[model samples]
Structure formats: structure tokens, C-alpha cells
Target: MKYSLVASLILQGSLVLGTRDLQPVHFKAPSALHFRDIVRNDTYDFGCRPIAHPTEDGQFTLHALLTESQIAHLTEEYEDTDLSIHRPSEKRAAAATAPIGSGDRFSGGTIAPIGLGTKASGSTISSILNVKEISSAVQGLVSTYGVTTLNLPYKTFNGATQFAAYVGAGTDKSQYHLYLSAGVHARERGGPDNLIYWISDLLAASKAGSGLTYGKKTYTNAQVKSVLAAGIVFFPLVNPDGVTYDQSSGSLWRKNRNTKSGSSGDSIGVDINRNFDFLWNFKKYFDPSEAPASTSPSSETFYGTAAASEPETKNHVSIYDSFPKIRWFMDIHSAAGDILYSWGDDDDQTTSTTMNFLNSAYDGKRGPVGDSAYKEYIPSVDLTNIKTAATAAVNAMKAVGGRSYITQQAVGLYPTSGASDDYSFSRFWAKSGVNKVYGYTMEFGYSTNFYPTLTEFNQNILDTNAGFMDWALAAISVGLT
Candidate 1:
């Protein structure tokens, strides 16, 4: 009876998901442009922002989280067109999602979270870390490995004190050149785990004067030390409030819990990834036709009240100011299985230096790929360095004997505004005398599968740890100073 009611309301195009499950659906279109039309609508949730992946049949596949009503609406709308939508059997999908860790796995900051790099083959993580365990895991490292944790300025909407950890560079903040962050989108499980465990491996291996291995991939003591010397500063659990809600309710939540906009389910949060200060005022910065980020509070890609409006977004931006010399930055996300690099606002062009994001002269002409209008300008040399680092990360991930990975320009399937990678890279051009930081977004695991099975969870740690290994080494090769 409830489902029938939902279906009826969906036909009227007025019903929203209220404690209902979000079905995972895939839409295949003859060309990628068909997705551009879908992206403009504010009702859908594209995992960590949509990027259309090419299928073997010469079509594009976009993975989305939608209600049964939304899927039914799209099914009816595209029935006569070349576009098609599909969902797997509910029973099969129901059992495959991995479980979230029920108790504090870190035992309230006493036990360090060990990664797959140190475990035997086929070993699995019991579950994804609970929200409190994310903090506990990092604190365990402080006592065990001499890690320093610094508190950020802003408290979350829930009044949570956010903190970041930096090691190997000592007390001088400017000495750190590599920065990493995870859990920006709360439901991307294992993102914080991947970073924390990798840091554990680096510190442990350095202390023992040993090597680290992730399945078939291996890193020597020298490689580990080189990456450590680059000085990594990590901000894990950017949206603890949202994560706690998602873990407790199993709602697949993807934003920070801020109620200033709307105070109910599906309308209670802002996407931290989309709330960054780069091209954040999408209506003014991007092409008028493009919905690079949504304006609606209920939308998954909502840009929020203003640029860097949410405390999570502000805390992330403040990291760069605290560490002025950070030469490389990475924001970890999941389920896309690719490593993405900068200029996500539009197609990247290496020729015209003046046609960049800061110029108000090209304000209304910035998006739309393959057009004669303005494309985001990137220096050819900078482009090469980003591409090199991106390729190295994905290559090492593929070499882990688990899955194949690829590198892509961040703006591949659809353009995005205010994304972390673009904001990191834009700082070099937007600010005066700041270090030029090449930004990257690493999307790991299966397509749209944020909650991995136990096997995939273990595999994700292996794949990402190796990827981080090569990513840091490649950055060092490109020169940190």
C-alpha cells in the first residue's frame, strides 16, 4: 500500500524520498549529451557527482541514486528514445552491500586500525569504521607513532570539533608539501579508513626499517621514507555529523548535517564537496545553461547558502592557509574507480592563458565542451605534471591484482563547479605568491558502490594504499619544493 501511494505521488512529480530506500539505477544513452539534460534537474543523486562512463556498446552509462518513483518517471520519459535505464535484482543487490562497523573498532582510541598492506592475502576488514571510530583510529596513531593532531577553527553544525593530523615535517607548517583529505561526502565508506591505515603502514614501516606490501604491489623502505619526507597532512572525517546519521539509519547520506536551509529528511544538509569557494556562485561563474551545481537545498549537489558556507567546507579551505607550501593535494572519494585531475569547471585548454576561471570577461561562456566559447585555461606544463601523477596512481592501483583503474580529466562526463580538485589547483592562479598545488580526486572501488562487500572493502584498501604509494612517489619525482 505504501509503495502504491509512492508510485501515485511520483506520477504527480511531487513526492520526495522520506525514509524510503534509494535504488541504484544505471542510465545508458546513445551519447553523453543526454546526461547533460538529466544533470540540470535538482531531484536526482549522482554518487559523488556524476561522471558518465563509456560502455563497450559505444554508449555512456551514468550511475545514480534515485527513488523508485524517479526511476519510474525516467523509464516512462525515455521509453521512446535510445536512452535506457536498468536496475539489478533487488535481492542480489540487497545482500551485497557491506556492513558498517557496529561498535568502536578502535576501542575508543586505543587500537590502531591495521590496513590490508600488512595483512595476509584474502584478509578482510570486519566492517567500515563507525563515525566515532574515525576519530579514535587517528588518536591511536598519535599515541603509537608520534602523530600530531591540530584542531581546526570551525565547529560543525552539530558542534563537533574538527581536527587534522600532520607528521614527518615537524613543527614548521610550511615544511609540509603533501595534503590529503577524505570523508567529505559522508557515505563514501572506507575513505577515512584508507587514509588512516595507509598512514599507519608508513609510520610502522619507517620505524621498523622495513618494506610495505599490498597484495602483488610492494614498496621498499626508501620509497616509504621518500613519501614520508614529503610531509603528509590529512584531514579525515570532514562531515562527522552526516556520517553518524548515515551509519545509524543506513540512508546513504552524502552531505554535512546543517539545518539552516531545510530541517527535515532529504532537505537537511549541504554537499561539502560542492560548497568550496571555486566558481561556487555557479549562476554567476558558469554558463547560464549549465547546472554545474544545484541551487536547491534538497539536491545532492547543492552548493549551499554561499561559497564555503558550511563549517566542513571552511575547515577544508583553511588547511591551505595553515600549510602555505603544500605542493600537492588529494581529496579521496569512492565507487568511480578512477583518478581525476583539475579544471573540472569545463573542458581544459592549454593554449589561452587569459581564458581562465578568475576572468569576469568570460563569465557567461565558461562551460560546454567542444565549443568555440571559453574553455578553462591550464598551463601545458602544469597539465603534464597533473596527468603524470594521476596516471601513476591509477597504474599502481591496477597493478594490485584486484581490478583495472584509469585516469581521467575531472570534467570528463559532466562539468562540476566548486569541487575540491579544481579549488586546490585554482589557488595557484587565484592567489598571490602561494605555492602551486596540483590537486587530484581519487575515486576508488566499483561504480556507484559506496558500501563495498567485505571482499571489496579489503581490496579497496589494497588498491588505494598502492595508489597512494605511487601517487606520493610520483609527486616527489615531479619535485615537492
Candidate 2:
């Protein structure tokens, strides 16, 4: 009944607040163009008079009421890029030479097809997996390969469950782990689906007695053996209810399904990304007046009632506690084409050498040179690796799909509080002083919000797979000088 009410309201474009009073209330956006996470200053007249607040990047975060026709118009704009259109594959490699002092150029062999349900060209929603399907696929991998499925105890507002897969749990528990998560914002469907494709490729490589290869670098069977021993953990979908809702209603819902105390009015759900406990609403990077995240429940970036208020937020905390061996973490999102490192609140973090390295590397440069700068790393983070592994990953992604993903500090892009990557890094580095786990956030794609068509979606998955693999390698190779 709760689900039906929301869905019905979305279809009707109006909600009743009192007897004989119909309000033109804009609820969660019904399409990608209206995604609440987007920072836009332009206000098209939607009924109920949309409200706007200033955000960074010279844009405004909006909460608006739109009529049914307005939503249709917005959706038509989003569909401008057809999903069914096939995109030609990019050239297999970059120019076959090196530029002196410009940095190491990645040369690589042709990409091998390790099928995880993407076509050589074009994209299709049919290839993507739902929550139940994801669970089944994970179980299949567990049975066929040595992967282990770990279930989280949390359920979404619609009673949907969440789970994860562990690739090396049977090995020594002391081995470090690489943690990757996607689908934190339900409408960003690519991240979760991309993880499945990546996991499938890794499992396939493991089964075939071959190592995974990204660009020119191939992890030989020996390196593969060692990396597998180190462990890989993946959370494919963090907000199942929200994903289900988006796919069903064609709405770009960015938060969890938590609603206002049994009321079906206005917007519901907290932005899970802003609900983490660390530095939550920290005045420097986040104040309700200045940040996209809000104290009100109706906001797309709504911070929950209190820090770590939602089950999803608590579940991530449990994950952090469960894995003391976690050496690298990435919270993947889409449509930005960026590989972001932590200290998300600011570009210059007092404690981060990595932050300093990145700010200098790509501060003013734009386009390819700036995009390649993610490889810059400070030696103090790890004596064994003065070279950052992120550059190789970024380059590999470019080489595969020609998507230029810039690497930088998280705050280099925008101010965020209670970000998962920041919290993950803070858990080990700031609070525990371990400083072993290096955290990251990979914002994939070069398009608008999370509503890419199948063609764009498949390309994004292909483009990002290389970077994901590189990050996994870096996680396992930490502290090796």
C-alpha cells in the first residue's frame, strides 16, 4: 500500500494534504533531468513554485513541485540520448610513443572479452541485474568459484535486503581486503551493474587459471594468486528499495526509502551519502544553509534525523568494523568521470599528503593532462609506493573506452560531509591512526546525472573496469616499498 501510494502520486502529479485541498506538490523527480543531486541554477516554472538554494559549481539545488506535463517534458529531455543507439568502440590504444617528463604513458594489449553481459556495441537494460538476480549470481559464483556471500542484516524502507560478496574469505584472514560499493544512490544503476561485470570478469579469470589484465599490465598467474589471497569484497547494491523504485517508476530517486512517520506526503527518505557519522554536518564543508544536504526530510540530500540514523548507514559501519584488514575502499557513483580520493571536505587537508599531491598535479590544468594527474601520490602514505596507482587505472579506462576520468581530491570537485569514502578513510587514518587503508570515490562517466542510456551505460562500465582493477591491485600491494 505504501509503495502504491507513492507510485500513484508520481503518476498523478498531485497529492491531497487536507480535505478538499489538492496541492501541486513535486515529489521525487520522475526522470533523470530532474535528479535532485544535480546542481542547477535555472528554474523553469513548475507548478507549486520550486524552491532553490545556492550550491558550489555556481549552481542551485532545487526542491520543486511539477505538474504531470512538466515531468513529461523533463523526461523527454533526458531521453535525448537514446539508449538503443550503438556506439562504435574506441581505438584499442593511444599514440605509440612516450612524451619525455610528461609522465609514464600506458601501452597495452587489446582488451579480451570476458563476458559479464555487455555487447561489443550498444547497451540494454536487460543486461542489468535486479537485487534478487544479483543475489542468485553471487550464489552461483560462490558455488562455482571459491567466493563467499555475506549478508548484511539491514533492509530498505520497502523491506528489500542487502548483501555482499567476498572473493578471498577462505584464505588467510590477515590478508588485506579491497572493498568496493555501488548503488548508494538508487537511480545510479550503472555502478551496481558495473560491479557485477567486474566481479564476473575476475571470477572468470580465476577459474581459467589466468590473471586479469588491464592495458599493458597483466597480473600473471602468480600475481593473480597473491591478489586473490588478499581478498576482494563487493557491495553491489546498497539501496535496493530505491533502485527498485527508480527502475519501476522511472524516477531518479537519490535517497533511501525511509519516509516521514507514516505519512505519504511530500518527499521522504534521507540521503544515505550524507548520513554517515564522521564529521557529519561539519561546519566547514557542510551547513544546511550552504550545502546540498539538508536537515529537512524532503531534500534529496537530506541528512537523517541524527548521525548514522539509517540502517544503511549503520550497515556500512558494521562493514568497517568487520574488516580490519581493509586496505583500500571505493564508493562508486556515476556521470562525473572522476576518480576522487578522500579528505572530501576540503582540497587541502592538514593530515593528507595525498591531498597536497593531487591539488598541485591538476589544479589549473584541464582536459587530458589534468585528467591523467590522478597518478600523483605522496610518499609518506606508503614508503614502498611513491607512485600513485590511480593514474594507471585512469589511463587504462581511457585506453579501453576513451573516457577521460580526472583524478583529484574529493573536495576538488565539491564540498561534501559524511561522505562514505571520507568516513572510511577517517576510520583508519584519523581515528585509529592506522593510516593503512587508502580510501577513494570513483565517480564514473562524463554525462549528466545517473540516467545514461544503455549505450552510454555499457561504455561507462567498460571504461571504469580498468580503474577498478587497478585500485584492487593497489589495495593488495599496499606497504610494498
Candidate 3:
């Protein structure tokens, strides 16, 4: 808390966040007791702020990207405490990571990106979709499945016109109760592929009246029809410009390609995920000790100049206006295997309705983790529905026969502001007469392993597709209307 506040003051001068050539590393903390203090630093980047998972013996393992200097400083400080840091090598990263696709895989929208679930067993995806392939795959979906695509009103800084699609909902936009999206973070590769392929599986299975199998987890023809009947509205590839830069430069870029903030280096773009209107002005809504989102442009989680400032964020928000009855939403991302629920800016509470995000009574008093000051109010029914749906998705991911996943509230070890999941859920209370929507984030793949190997990429598709199936099924079970 002390370090974060001091850093915040220094940032008042509009200093650019310091840049570094960071490498992913694992820190085995002595226990969650020690891990909590370390994560509260706010200076350290625990990718997506997931809780440190337990090791077989008893210790907790945390993943982060750190510069050599930061690593050295922490090493010196925590050497006596047995806080061990281990560098990972899937044969030194590059060798293991699947290459980004060089040319159009979808043949300029002529062919759809078929998912692994629809193919015979032992299928594989050759590479991560290139920027062009991302669009072409979406085009293929429209061409092949009769999906409706609408051009989002806002154009990105790079002059790209973004769009979103809706399918399996017949003609009425309001019938689209379930929403799934991806490519919010440029370097979280395969997220778009995971969502696109899952859509294809649903369409194909519904057409053929056959079952869908993702490894050991299988959905019958009836289950497939039921999920499709729930309706799906998806915006795949939310940040096109960022994905373009990340794909071309091989940099771990996580923001839009907007240079309004700064012209060069890390000063280039805004973190679109952190630009949502929910608690966007973290300095006003959160406590001094909490750094939910950074004010520095060069920081990866920069909240941007204003809420919904970026055109991409506006396009994302525009979806709710178009499809007002959306009851469930899931934003897809990678490198952290978690299914995150609502209340990212603080802990969730069922009793304190007046202390919620929509209530100005708790301004400047929120964001502390274990505190008595304020807690975000979520009704008991809403909490049960979200948790039940999250658990179903997590169990389905494990049943895919590849890996395991956990479901938790979005605020795990630290808080965040303007995140998509929180903003989607907060809409009900923040705006009058808005439909009640349950929001979720599916963080797939290995921790900090942004560029998964081809094997892992294919495995990720299977794991997440099964997860989507159960998530949507559970959402329907809980009630879509």
C-alpha cells in the first residue's frame, strides 16, 4: 500500500510507465500469506491478477513477467524468505511457441475456420491466426452459416472499421441472450480461434443433428440445439490494430494501436480492457492504496484519457445498445487459466446493497481486499447464478481431458477498474431500466504462456469450447430471460 501510493504521486506528472524487456517467471511463495503482500505491490504484473495456485507440497505458485532488474531487486530482498524465482523455457520460448500464420488461412473469407471439435479425433491447428485471418474467419462464418454481421459504428485509430456478429438466435437481436467475445488483448493468441471454432461446432452440430465432442466431454445433439437456441452474439477480435502490431512485431502488445497518448515506444496505445466506464476513474472511485488501473500511458493497464475513450471500447459498449436483452456475457482472453466472475474492483457482498458501485456513497472508500469500509453489492440470487454457471464451465474445461481450471471472483489477489467483465455486470445497476446481465471472463491457456505451442493451442481450443458449451447450458438452466 505504501509503495503504490508513493508511485501514484510520482505518476501525477504524467510520467510514462517505464519499459522493459520482460520475461515470464514463476515465483514459489512460502504461502498465500506471503503471496498476498507481494501481489499488493501493484508494481508487479501478475498476469490477470489470478490467485496463486497451490503446489503439491503446500507452497503457492505465482506467475509474472519481470525485468532482470526487478528480478534482482526481489531476489535480494526476499532471498532470506525463500521466495524462489524460476525462469521457464519451453526450449527457450520461441522454439516451442507455434508460429503466427504468415498468409490468409481462410482464403480471404472464402473458407471458414473449422474447429477441432468438428473434425475427426487428433486434429490440430497449424498456427495462430494472422490479423487478416481473424477477419477472414469471421467472414467465412457469415458466408457459411448465415450469421448476421453488423459494422460497429466506431472506427479504430488506424482507420479499421470493427464489426460484431450474432447467430443461432433467429432474426430478433433481443433474442441474443448469450454473448461471447475475444481478441481483447492482442498477445493472448488463440482466443479468437477458440471462440470462432466453438461457434462453428454449434452450427455444424445443429445442422447435422449430431453430437459435439471435445475430448472426453461430449454434448448430445439435443444439448447442442438447446445451447444454440439460447442465442449467441459474438465480437471476435475487438482490438484489430493491437493484434496487427503484436502479430507483425512479435512484441507482447496488449493495447489498441492508438498513438494519441504517446507517439513512440510503450507510449503508443491504451489498454482497451481497462478503458470501460466501470470504475474507470480509479483515482476517484478507489482508495489511495489501491492501483486498480494505471494513469501512465506506457503502463499495460492504462485506463485511457476517459471512460469508453477508445473507439474499440465504444464499439463493445454499442453491443448492449443493439442487443439490450443480453442476459449473459463472456469475454475471452488467455495465458491465465481462470473463469473470473464479477466485482473486479473490490470484494463482492450480498448484504450491502447501498454500498454498491452504482452508489456514490462509497466513493474513495472502495478497492481494499480484506476490509470493512466498502464492498460491491451483488444480490444473493445473482451471486448464486454466476457461481453456478462458473463452476459448470470450470468442470467442463477439466472434463475435456487436457487440463483443469478454477472459477473465482474477478478480484483475486488485487483489484482492477474498467475491466470488461465488471463493466458488463455493473450495467444493470449503473443504468436505469437496463437488463440484468451476468458477466464472465474465460482466461484460458497456461499462466503467462501467451504464445502456446501448437499442441497447447489445439488443446486450448478443445478445453475452452467444452467450457463454453457448459457455460451457456448452465446460463440457460439458470434462466436466460
Model 3: residues with Cα > 4 Å off, grouped in runs = 1-20, 36-43, 89-95
lDDT of 3 at 115: 82
Candidate 3 structure lDDT? 0.86
Tens digit of per-residue lDDT, candidate 3, span 181-230: 89999889899989989998888888888889999999999999999888
Residue pairs with colliding backbones in model 2 are: 26-65, 108-216, 384-481
Error of 3 at 268 (Å): 1.4
Global Cα lDDT for candidate 1: 0.86
What are the Cα lDDT values of the candidates?
A: 0.86, 0.56, 0.86
Q: Which one is best on lDDT?
A: 1
* TM-score for each model: 0.94, 0.68, 0.93
Pick by lDDT: 1 or 3, better one = 1
Q: On residues 1-481, what C-alpha lDDT tens digit does candidate 1 reach at each position?
A: 6997777556334323455479888888988888888876767888987888877788988889888889989999889898899886676496676778777877878877776666666777878888788899998889888889999999999999999999988889998999999999888888998998899889888888988999889999999888998899999888899887777666788988899998977788998988888999988877788878889988888889998999998999899999999999999998888899987988899998888899999988877867878788899999999999999998899999899988888988577888898999998888899889999999998877888888888889999999999999999999897
User: If the candidates were sorted by their TM-score against the true structure, best first, what order would they fall in?
Assistant: 1, 3, 2
In model 1, the runs with Cα more than 4 Å from the true position are 1-18, 89-92
Give per-residue CA lDDT, model 2, range 316-384, as digits (tens): 766656666777778888656667665555434233455432243434221111233222233444422
Which segments of candidate 2 are over 4 A away from where they belong?
1-126, 169-172, 211-223, 283-289, 349-387, 433-435
